[model samples]
Target: MDDARQPGRAYRGRRRAQAAHTRYAAVLTTAVVGAGIVALGVSTALPEPRNDLSLEASGNFDDVSVRGGTDRAGRSRTSNPMSNMPAPDVWILPMQRYTLTSFYGERWGRLHPGVDLGAPQGTPFTAVAAGKVILCGWNGGYGNNVMIDHGDGIVTVYGHASKLLCKEGQLVKAGDRIALTGNTGHSFGAHLHFEVREHDKPIEPLAFMRKHGVDIQKHTEAIYG
Candidate 1:
């Protein structure tokens, strides 16, 4: 039994070498998997920026792969920023002589939902942008109203007017006079009740004013500060 050049001990030595290799392979596999996970976290950890000067949304994106992971190619997902930015236009004054008496969200008996641009009776009023007239007749509390449905879920309403110039289903361009300022229903004096809405919800006209590069406050502070 102790013959044939010690074959038993030689075979045991071969088995030990094989086991060492197997263990090394296992450790290598674990390290590769850990590195992949860390890389994925870095790729998807991008931050979104929020400000008026910047776009609405951030990242060059696609349909989310797993709500918080990369695509198969290991690239990060992002949404198109321009997709959320609404179209903006110039703020052309509708009347030659006008003043803002009431602003958006001013609390009257309840809440004043719009801005009141004061002008003389029968003064001409114009559209703020190119849009289709959705409502061209008298509204309950807004006499002789003209609501222009601008594209991209934007709408502009001219209320408390003395005359209506556009009809329903009519398309109008910017600076087109749509009505005249009046002291009609629910008005304090001769003024135009102007409203800018997004998704049918009223927003402040000053927001649009700032978008068009007009500062609500005096030019000195806005410029210096």
Candidate 2:
């Protein structure tokens, strides 16, 4: 009787253990599958990675603009549409002259550095372009002088003036009278000494005037003939 009861009790215990293991295995499998689903959902909800890094510098990576991009050589490019455009047109002859007294070059064993136009004393001399008067006073060798800044490193200097009509810092238009012709500074007679300078270096005033659309030769011929 004792042996028979022991066998029955062992069989019941083994069945109960099997059932408990099956329930635990089902719960573990369900938890693992739920965690995998949640991870997949989170990955899908995130934003996609971008391949074009053109606007990374500006922090506008998603904004694709038409102006900035690669050129034909695959180098980076930027837009500057007006860089090659022509400068503004404001040209005029500084004064009516009787004759060209001295040219802009070596003279008397020294550099003349300007053009001398012999005109009647007290004749008004005008500005070649619209600008502001940077200097107006009696300079040492230049005598009563006037200098105008016409922007873009261009400056026009008028020396040996008998009188200055415009004061320093005064804004004047093209062809405005700025001074009067005179024999004030190291001069032999009444005339106007005009100089066109680019970045403080003197350039030929006649050629510079002609290049800016002022016909200096035409003005000379018309005045002479």
Please state the error at residue 139 of candidate 2 in Å.
Answer: 0.9
Each model's C-alpha lDDT?
0.50, 0.55
CA deviation > 4 Å runs, candidate 1: 1-90, 214-225
Residue 67 in candidate 2, Cα distance off native in Å: 49
Question: Best by lDDT, which number?
Answer: 2
> Which candidate ranks first by TM-score, i.e. highest?
2
- Cα-based TM-score, every candidate: 0.55, 0.58
TM-score, candidate number 1: 0.55
Task: List the RMSD of every prediction in angstroms.
Answer: 31.7, 43.3
Model 2 lDDT per residue over 1-225, tens place: 011111222122112212323423533443344322110000001012232211111221111122122341132113222223322235556754446777887665555667887887887778876566756766545667787766566778787788889986566655567888877756778787888877655678888887765655456211111
Per-residue alpha-carbon lDDT of model 1 for 57-115, expressed as tens digits? 11111211233344521431243222233323333344434676766653633445567
Clashing pairs in 1: 61-78
Off by over 4 Å in 2: 1-88, 220-225
